[model samples]
Target: MRKKAVRNQLWVPIIAMTLLIAGCGTKTEPMVDTAAGSKQQQSASPAPAPQTPVETVELTISAAASLTDALKEIQTVYQTKATSTKLNFNFGASGALQQQIEQGAPADLFLSAATKNMKTLVDNQLIDAGKQKNLLTNELVVVVPVDSKVSIGSEADLSKPEVLHVAIGIPESVPAGSYAKEALTYGKLWDSLQSRMVQGKDVRQVLQYIETGNADAGFVYKTDALTSNKVKIAFAVDPKSYQAVEYPIGIVKSTKHGKEAEDFYNYLQSKEALDVFVKFGFTVPK
Candidate 1:
């Protein structure tokens, strides 16, 4: 009876040991599966999303040649502020630009040095009359080469014998030339100066003539004369001599980007743009 009792005690211990071993194996297998699942989830994480691009709109502006310097500065400011819109400028004589618009050239806006060109466009329905406004004013001036020795102090001096050739823009197309003609006519010197006049396609060309010494003197806007180191202002024509030198801006009737063009047009009247124009010798409209 003592031997049988000892055998029963040994069997109890063996059964307890077997049950513990089986529990450990089951728990370890589940732990290994859980660790593998965590690694797979980490490896399958998605990449960051791409950023959206900004939408950009481009506009074309047909402007008078005299606005070249001021508009270039304004363009820099506009681009910095209005990031979504880009301005492309087409600078030329207002009459030439008017003809181009009449011929169906692609332009979003028109900025004229004089109202006559604007009037022609308005008369032909090429511009939005409702959107038109005179933005600035300018003065007519006589310019001589930096090294000129002739005593030219007024429009009357342009007919002096020492002044061999005088440069002026074409009166039929360039507003500056038309103003020059009016000033000379007001002074009663038109016929006397006509024989010595050298005509250019635009005001810039007139300025170029004086700069290169191609002509003894030239007529240009005060703003145009201010841009050059090679020319000196010989005199400012009396305000009474010519009509008001007004600059008008308007939206084109055929512009596809009317909203953008209008926005830019309004921006030109802002203090920032006006400051630039003033720096370049343009006078703000009252």
Candidate 2:
């Protein structure tokens, strides 16, 4: 009976340890599986990538019609350096463009063919005075049709009674016309040729009249005369006869892209752009 009691005590202890180990093994298996699942979930998830910013800038430039070729060339050069920027150009008579700026058009830059139109903006405080700079110079010339026989030896030829329908830009609205008026006054033909004047909106328009043979003769800039193959250059007006026809550029006070506008303005003075200007028949500022 004592031996049986001893065996019963040993069996009870062994069974209790076996059941406890089994419970621990079951709990540890579930914990190991849960830890592995958490690691897999963390490894499978993806983090967000950083984003890149998009840069864009638009610059609007209002310039004279005569500058069409030169400015377009400059624009091509400018855009090459700053591919993210867009250039917008408004070409017309200086007086007309000045009026548009004065009316609060969104203009980042102003390039005028004449100082008079620039002065209009300066007087009104529409342009930054410190940012203004003279950029180019030009000379006026007389143009006639290729086959015309109007023997225009001097200013006196324009005063002949038969010289009817002489084309000139409207003196009040065009710089070329104002220069022509000064030339006429200095040559003593302003009064005699006043009645026969056929006024045009701009020098380019006056050139058109002569090219179409609708007018006997017209006054335009040497640069303007070079643009057309149909019109023959008769004579270049004396540069000393009138005030210097200087082209000026300035940053508008209302510019949203003032820094970029100034960048482009500085580029105009660079040698690369000046070469283009020279190729187009404009005298670059020294």
Candidate 3:
């Protein structure tokens, strides 16, 4: 009976130990599987993509007022090729633009309506003379309001009594005005038409004077006249009467962004830029 009691105690201890070991094994298996699953998920995850930075550069241009339309279109078309570069334009009379540059107005490049203004800058050492190029030519013409009955078939007719008010740019600061002076002086009409003159700051303003009927006749570039439908070309001023109208473009020597300005200056000589300028009625140098 004593031996049987001792054997029963030993059996009870073995059964308790077996149950404890089985419980530990069941808990440990799930924990091991969960740890393995976490590592697998980490290893299988996709990597992040690399980053690419965009270039941020903006260029400024000081151009003749007549180039406004063509350059704007060039700016649009150039964006396809130069996606990171931006263009800012300062358009005004060529002489005025020249003065601004001489006075240190912010400009990366200069486009003048006349070679005379460009030569002045070149002489001032503000532009590299070697970099200057005459890119366009324009015809000076007489314009009238679309509804006018005036018969101005020639530059001589500008002195007619019936055409009382004639618009022109101010000669001291306007290249178009300087051209008109040259034409009238060539025809011996500049001295006679002064009392009836309506002056403008730029060719476009002269264009406005005709379009608004403030002046019975005005002289402007063919390109300027083409920009408006409210005015009609009464006649083309004889090319022999004035200096040939040329558009000279160059990069300013003081430009902060020389490379970008040069890229644009070069682009202006491209076929795409010529297309836009020709479409705007400017003559590209062959």
Judged by lDDT, which candidate is best?
1
10 residues in a row with least lDDT, candidate 3: 24-33
Write the number of the candidate with greater TM-score, choosing between 1 and 3. Answer: 1
| Per-residue lDDT of model 2, residues 144-215, tens digit only | 898888788666788766668889888887899999999999988898887889999878899899999889
Question: Which of the predicted structures, 1 or 3, would earn the higher lDDT when compared with the native?
Answer: 1
Q: What ranges in model 3 sit over 4 Å off?
A: 1-55
- Using TM-score as the measure, the top candidate is 1
**Clash pairs (backbone) in predicted model 1:** none
Residues 49-107, candidate 1: write the lDDT tens digits: 89899889999999999999999989988899889999999999999999999999999
Using TM-score as the measure, name the better of candidate 1 and candidate 2.
1
Superposed model 2: Cα runs more than 4 Å off: 1-53
Residue 36 of model 3: what lDDT? Answer: 83
Q: For each candidate, what is the lDDT?
A: 0.93, 0.87, 0.90
